[model samples]
Target: MTTFRESLARVASRRSFLAVSGLIATAMCRPALAQDAGTPSASGWAMTDGRGNTISLPTRPERVVAFSPVAAALWELGVRPVGVFGPFRQEDGSPDPQIGEVDLDAVVSIGDWEEFDLERLIALDPDLLVGLSLPDVPNTLWYVPEDASATVEAIVPTFGVTPSDRGHLGLIEDIESLAAALAADLDAPGIVATRNEFTAAEAELRDLLAEAEGLTALVISASPDEIYVANPSWFGDLRFFLAAGLPIIEPETEERWEILSWEQAAKYQADLILVDNRGGGVPFPVLDPIGTWQSLPAVQAGQVGPWHAVAPYGRRAFSNIVRELTEIIRQTDASVVA
Candidate 1:
């Protein structure tokens, strides 16, 4: 598995090349139409994606190969995908936390990060390939290598859901709608219960935030050399938090992240610090030796928590995050930064 830093570097390099070579225009040559409501037709099931590509199959797709996060979201609604790709597994051979409660033993892993096993994916005989669409990259599926995207799409109908510029709740609703189109019972007791739990969690978080006046948080991913401050507007979870009355520090950048040197780590004084907890990031403990990091107010006050920027999108997954964040806010001292 590639480290998060390494993966970001690779993506940056590829994106730069794509920009220079005018491949973005070529990628947008695919069919574009208005978004559909994933309605079922007499001939088959037809659904449009975030990229405005409607995929029609002879029947409702039964064999689905999806990105790990997408699979995890569908799993919560009782839709079991046949195969999963992307960062679904960790280097230790354990299921990645981003996958939520997926049964790894039951599904085939088609690939990891930017690499895919074309042969294994083809063998799955998937009727649909689902993944998040990169907002900055036209028609590009997240985690699907740009070089192999054509080959992969040629094998099956592809569905993309974009996560950027929307709140997490909105994204969850989109996934729920997709699950319904896949024939999952939206009124299932488990699904309904989880939705109710998520609603309650949201309320609790809002109430807690109301009391923690002036409290602010900074979201970041750390590497050995630099700190990446996430742009809240580009992240569903952070956008959701901001909309829910949490004062998340928004970096001054159009890109998804603001890169900063170690010395500039204190550029934002936040009452609480949320460090990225994904497999690709360096753990917070590993930064204890860095004097600049240690000097941060939140770090000195011990008001730091883990941030799951790319966790599986669903009621259950998000509810857990909200509840955990509520507790962290409850324990944090709002005066830490001041």
Candidate 2:
């Protein structure tokens, strides 16, 4: 059995952006004739959002503005938005990578995660605004500031799909239901094929982990100042692995994450470590100055990898994530890590 670090080294050499794009294109190239691609002529439609609020639309929401991850999911469902509330341009002025391969050249930038351009959003005159929400925090938009929620919702009916509350499969199903109401083909061959692939990949992951009964992993967000260990209950991604029977060690403290001072991070050990990979996340190298971090076995052995904390919850994305982790587990040496 090879150590987790050695497995990762091999995995990195095999990753290919072009190959992934090809896969996504091949798996998700939706038909232009999709009903959801056209303006909805129906008089009205209704559905419940993440907040459990019944929202009635005068017609299918063709002109939409959504959070980045939600926007990506909508694209997979064959729906495009008028604007997205994420960085429109990267630092180099390229299209934001947050939305995956979705074309955003024509999509208005409502604003980034912290603040929204209320004037720009209103000018778009969107039919709907979408994002992730939690039932516990009703009325408030998840990433959007509370000060702007009322004004934003006033312009367009807001709907949210809470992934954390719904779990992985439920989240996909909810998005499917929303897409159906919007006239997207939930049974489209492309979508059906991706779903089938995701199911098979998930099963394979479970079987692979079953063979490594003692293998364990940890999810963390590291920064120059602190380390945050994710609790499975708080993250849909971590929860997915936990449900698959993977040994994901939870933080001892009874919160969504157990925060540790940078120097204290090495005390917790696991066979593998998944560090947050979003643009804002601090890279693993940031911990180099700390002796404790250097001593951590996972880090010393290079058993760390990027975790897409806010990946789109769609069939293709889920399938890819599961497959990647399955390969890592298969390559990892249980004895070395143990």
Candidate 3:
């Protein structure tokens, strides 16, 4: 029953504890051969992660284990992981929205967002572990618990890609680069087609936004008691929307999110409101009846849309999101808010 914010705070606290105890420093001392990209060196195969740590293996990794988002990105590029750890499923046993283009029945689910099964991960005999790295947390992979870090590091070479501040397009490019290194056929017909589709969708969005002036948007995630207003700079998708000329309301805070009580939900008025539609969030149906939520200008005017806040960093996934948003914007009333 732990909230997402509580889980993040726990991870940060655990990381700080590990750093002070010098476990992180000790792990870093382990020897690794350097190689640019996914090139073969005298040692074997090597690639540098987002944090600048070069991981080397005796051979190119065929059995990889990755966080769900990373696995989804690789899946779209035709690289299948042996196992995946993250929020890949909903309570009813359906695929989570964040898991894009990945066949859950085919891959091993090691764990969810809060924890991973170390024994299962070891049994997979993985040669590589891939996940995201947050800019705020150094030397730690996004979902891999800090308490299990040293053990996981000993099991396989780890690679991380930071998503924040890069924008969605930049993140997709990074994933494509990783896919190439992993021996993915970037020139494959499907891959090429998806890329083209993404480009077209981006252009369509840009064109629409060019003509649609005076429209403003607010991106948010909600719980029963509180709402988390996203800071676009920390979210790749939001940053891309902003860069594409979407007038997203910037929260008056430096942190990745501006947490507000439900009573304060109407503090920022926008023509459109994008609510996070990921699993584990309070759904629109549940919030619609709340007096404070119903009082928001966007809600009253019905200018609300779903936000895939953490879609896989793949062309196809993003293309779908962009197309959906484009349609929503096309139907939105810019005069919803004064």
Tens digit of per-residue lDDT, candidate 3, span 1-338? 22344433432353432211110111122222222558656778777766767777777889999877778889999999989987687767778756777999899988875578999998999989988765456778866888989998998888887543345666577778878888999999999999899889999999999998799999887767777787776566777798899999999996656888898988999999998665455377668778999998889888888877556767888899899999999999888887
Worst 10 residues of 2 by lDDT: 18-27
TM-score of each: 0.89, 0.82, 0.87
- What lDDT is obtained when candidate 1 is compared to the true structure? 0.77
Position 20, candidate 2: lDDT: 14
* lDDT, candidate 2, 65-97, per-residue tens: 887766777788887888888545555566554
TM-score of structure candidate 1: 0.89
Model 2 deviation from native, Cα RMSD in Å: 9.6
| Number of the candidate with higher lDDT, 1 or 3 | 1
Number of clashes recorded per candidate: 1, 1, 0
Deviating ranges (above 4 Å) for candidate 2: 1-43, 94-97, 280-282
Clashes of 1: 1
What is the C-alpha RMSD, rounded to one decimal, of candidate 3? 5.7
Backbone clashes in model 1, listed as residue pairs: 4-280
Which window of 10 residues has the lowest lDDT sum in candidate 1?
19-28
Ranking by TM-score: 1, 3, 2
